[model samples]
Target chain A: MIALSINWHAEDQAWLLVAQNRRGLPFGIGGSQLVAGGALLALSAPMAGRVASWAAVNPHDPTPLLRPPAWDDAVVAAAILGAALLLALLSRWTERLGLRTMLEMRSEEGREPLVGPVSVTLGPDRATIRGATWEASYDAALLTGIEEPPGYLILRFGAARPVMLPRRDLTEPDAAAVRDWAAGVLGHDDAAP
Target chain B: MNEVSSGTPPRRPWERPVTPPSARPAGLWTSPAPDRGPVLVVRVDTEDEVAASRLAVAAMTPRGGLGSAALGGLVMLTAVTAVLASGSGWKSPVPEGLPLLAILAAIAAFAGLGWLAGAYLLPLVRRWASVAHARRVLRPGPDGVPPDGGGPARVVLGTRALHWTGPRAARRFDVALLRGLVEDRDHMMLRFGLVSVVVLPRRDLAPEQQEAVRDWVRRHAREGRA
Candidate 1:
């Protein structure tokens, strides 16, 4: 388990979720996405340069493009375009899957990324989050695994990704108790991994 | 005088004229401070000292909501243009520009942009002007006197003493006396006791100058509470 920094803020959980959600979106889907798209487009720049050179040499030939090894050029152009589209779609799909997994795990763990203070209650087979703005409960049996990463407590509930909770809000004594509690509850289930 | 009287008078129009040495102004005082550093050093004549200091403090006056106001105006302009472009049979605001009124709408949108620029950007320019004015007023000319000489006083800020030199002068105010720093409209007030000095824009100050002020006030603020 990584020791949490004293300067950390509890509300950082909201920002972490936001960052995670942003990460789930593929490159070229929002701001700064254009850089990746532009790089992909540049891959075809050499072919474009060749086309420009060919057109300049055959200025009088209106059908210069048609005069080329037509089938090969068409196939190459189509393949490049197809590759670009396929990559973009794949990126978008993976991001969405990651976002879904995070959200699902968050729901199962009965935690939410919000600004207000949060309190928790854990029993033999259930967990509850009492937030200033919201309250939620979850079946503790759904907790599949727990990862005690540095500065964070991540709980996995049958999702590809886990729900992260920053440990900044917890005092040293409280952190130790929570750590012990998690170790006991997840001890049997986490044994598989 | 002899050349003029002896008819060796002014040469050809192409020739330059010799002028007498200009007499320097009296009672002018220039501070012994260095102005080439990161610190904002202003040398004001004793007479203009207070007003000039006020103007300097005014420079720190924060202009609030300028960004939001500009953005809102831009969004409104875009919405108006989009509406005008659609030609959705909406009545023309400036009826004579045409039945379509697109050109008139564009003109009106541009006018709104102009207004936004004037309202938000002009104050920023004015704040810089105040800083420049203070700097010029404070910088002593070759004669060991401020160019805009009026008094014998000098105030050197962002310096070792944060010194003010003159009669009845509070020569130095320890950073510990820095009670608070705040902005009021177009002027920033640096409070000490119940008094505050207006100063220039924070952006106009060199990074070191800004940091010096920040460190001074912040350290003092923490100490004062203790």
Candidate 2:
């Protein structure tokens, strides 16, 4: 079994599932970054060359994507690496800030691709769920909307895709507590798997 | 009423006629293919009531659903990097080693994006696989059942046969048998233990074809009413 670091929490009144390919703690994380960089370097090298060629052809336009301005491969690689880092940082930071208002969830308008013992938790009606998906709700009514899903449950809006809530693994009565609450909302029953 | 040569032939996965003679319902009906209202036979299994309700609610949700982790993950990955770079002085402390951090950031971002993308893609693939696999398991549509297989002219299931297959692995019920992986949430599943239905004229099916299928299933089998 591939070991992935997954954390389950609540963000924006929704559940979140997070997984990364990092092994161990502390320094191992730093190594993971290097792996990511290697991938980026592999991708950007070709892109850099393509950009340089594009520059030769389209001399007038912005022509920014075409290769780096330096002669040394390392220099060009650094520039690309730097850009990827900045983008990654910016994307991550921006994604976090997005949790507050959830202005545009277009990026999150789908299902997660994980198959395993997913985790779960109950948040204050208005609490935001913290996982691969970041949703916040304002009331307990959100729980009512919960339904059994293929893998996990998201319960953000009307009739969304099914999700596998960790509750199923719980004993009948325990699971029923949550299931009953949810059934009241979706207006259906799912007492069993 | 307008009756235009309506009747369908019987069909099933097994070579033997799976449709029960006693399963016929008294009423009008329609065909899966428009204008081909031929008489058809279908075998529906009755599932457990509690389980049926559970499965129905579960089915109502499409498949491979995602919650709010997308945004949360994006925020967390950024926070980790920023706190390190800005607080620890890694952001601009040394340009050389900074490359490593940057590389890490990209992976985090891609992984997050990939996770969300998988949610959508996985379900779609799983659904297709289930339908195809179901077709394979119940070969009557191909083998004994003619290409012009018969459909339920009108099916009315009884309450005693509402059993869901509960994800059978060909031989018996298992979580792996269901619309699995993406669709089954890693659990093999098949529905039907106890259920009941009453088949009726399908031409009267107002909305979706899925409704027609349900109508057929209901007619064939159902849970014993409480």
Candidate 3:
């Protein structure tokens, strides 16, 4: 299992914590910390022997931002690319550290109160949110498939996505505990899945 | 509130006096008054949204920041790449000025495209932000249900923070840069990719759930402010 984290803060800033794994495949996650409404909406890794082929016609152009701002449009431009490459590098670094690639890795552990499956359980005294199946614990389970339903939370993305939980019955505190704990674990933003 | 001759009068209790659009504020800005009239409310925890939608995400990925900067950088990168690929010392047939200039022009176009992409996709992000906020201030309102519509079998992964509900007024959300999307009783139609969102009423949610719902509405308005 690989252990790494990425943080996408507001004001257009991002950070990555990359550490190599044993499978010769890197492992890591990336998203936003700030600007709660907008986070990493997409992520992908080519199948076996597909990267080189994809790179052949790779449409990505790493041109530099030449705009000269009074303060730092250029600085921001550089940071933009810097963040992208950093995310990419961190992924590779995780591989070098022997961690499996996110596409290949699965989570099996995380904080407690999380039993298994997906659903939002609310009963007499509890609130709990359950995560999905993965070989790695919370440390390596890069959350994917994030959505917004202008219906919950404080961010302005309008959405009404249903909750995910495993327990058929739950306590009131379990529901509240899950809600509070999940927010704390996932942070205020939708960076992690 | 004056009743519109036609549609259902969905006005909230606090929105007796409506504010004119002209009196609104300017740029990346939120209205001084959080309470325009009444607020839209909802309450769902891990129970309503079955784990069906849950997925893993990194703690803090710079996707939003990247989207913001993409306009500035993507253009330049594509242009430079085109110029280099045109190779000054190659048996290439493409001309120098035309190809280089074309690349520059393409850069400009790509930049615009990036901005457009960011604008259109924000609402989807905003929708999730509500759930994120709900997770933070998790509390069953009156009943032990998730929220009203959420029943008792939903799942919640996290939250951003719930905002207090504003009075009757025009709450907004930025669909894109400088773009304002109002979600009041008048225009409650939710248009998503080719589908419409069926939003429920606030009464359905528990008290705590109601707060979460109000926060979601306020946040939706705030997204536009950004």
Candidate 4:
């Protein structure tokens, strides 16, 4: 068994990304923006056309177009667009906040580290993770895939919470060995000969 | 050792269990029941249908009931505003010299009201639809079978999978693929993957059977966590 210690940080963006992906954000950031922008344009196009028509009819009298009421449509459109943008940002912030709160509660205010400074023992076909209050053994054959994202290794099992192992705690050779072992267990072509 | 020498071929990992006719659970006829363990049969009714529809919608929209309603209201408001603007000969609806803040506030208030109204009303509409669907599908005949000849609607729970036989179709949900199991006051929702759910009403189940179902869910959930 290859045993390694992990200094887990719950505040990591990698974890956030994993959490967000698992929960699944409908429309996502760019998609939401696109939908909001498209709706704004669609809602405002009629108003724009109407203004153009008014201008065409009363070309001489620019006074009506300059009135405050004339800009009501624009104001409403801008407000809606603003609300949409604000909502997008708020949703992202809320998710992160909620994740932090959940972690805090689970870890009991840092008295117990849910994933912090945990010891992991990698067997030929399974990995045993020991936390402060809990220990879980995961079968490597059941793992869907292994994600190597920058300085972390994420073990993904279908419908189960992924296990994140930071590479900083392990020696380079050890990290490589773990990755190759996982790859081999998962039947990936990149596994070492 | 020769190519011709063969007993029954070894079962593949993904092959479904071939339950014998004698061991098949009662009230299930569409296919062979999973022979993993004891089977629990739960009958379907209008309430179960309604709950299923509600749960399905909830699963589809992860933002919860209020958020989904609010979003719907916003979209509807935008469409309505556009239509009215076009109909009113392009004239501004606001009075002259109206403050931008006031206009924004009024719009926000309208959206909020719409959201509340939708949140209240959408469930009623869903319930009505579900009731109608149940009437059509689960309408019992004099012989206790469906008039449409599709047979009785029921869900058979096994250790390895869930078999749901509706009025017109049957679905098999493998236990390994189930994402979560949620039990509320009236229904037990078996969530498969993300959006698929099987709602089993507890009204027809005996207390001991209900406990058995709970125990099964608990055991599987723990295994899944492990």
Interface-residue RMSD per candidate?
A: 29.1, 21.1, 19.8, 15.5
Fraction of true interface contacts that also occur in model 3: 0.01
Model 2 regions more than 4 Å off: A1-193, B1-89, B93-115, B139-154, B157-226
> Superposing all C-alpha atoms, what RMSD in Å does each candidate have to the true structure?
27.6, 20.0, 19.4, 16.6
**Native contacts matched by each model:** 0.00, 0.00, 0.01, 0.00
Candidate 2 per-residue lDDT, tens place, A102-124, comes to 31232132222122223334432
Candidate 3 docks at the CAPRI level of incorrect
CA displacement after TM-score superposition, residue A145 of candidate 2 (Å):
45
Task: Please give the C-alpha DockQ score of model 2.
Answer: 0.02
lDDT of candidates 1 onward, in order: 0.41, 0.32, 0.29, 0.51
Cα-based TM-score, every candidate: 0.29, 0.24, 0.26, 0.43
Binned by DockQ into CAPRI classes (incorrect, acceptable, medium, high), candidate 2 is incorrect
Predicted candidate 3 versus true structure: per-residue lDDT over B1-226, tens digit per residue: 3555557574434323333334332221132323233333433343333211211121112234346446434545643554356552122343435444444455555455445455545434533543354343333433332422232211111122112212111122212111112233222222111111223333354455444444544444323321
> Can you write out model 1's per-residue Cα lDDT over A1-193, one digit (the tens) per residue?
2222222133344344334323433332321222333333333333332333323233333453344444654665566566666665555455445444544444343332333345555555545443432333344444555666577766653231234566765677766765676677767756765
Residue range B139-222, candidate 4, lDDT tens digits: 343334321123354455566666554343345655654555666678877765433466667776677667666666776542
DockQ agreement of candidate 1 with the native complex:
0.01
lDDT of 4 by residue, A1-193 (tens): 6788887665553354434332434433333433444454446434443444333233334553354444766666676666666665565556566556655553444333343677777777666665543344445554556777787777754322356777777789888888877777767534635
C-alpha displacement of A182 in model 3, angstroms? 21
For model 4, fnat equals 0.00
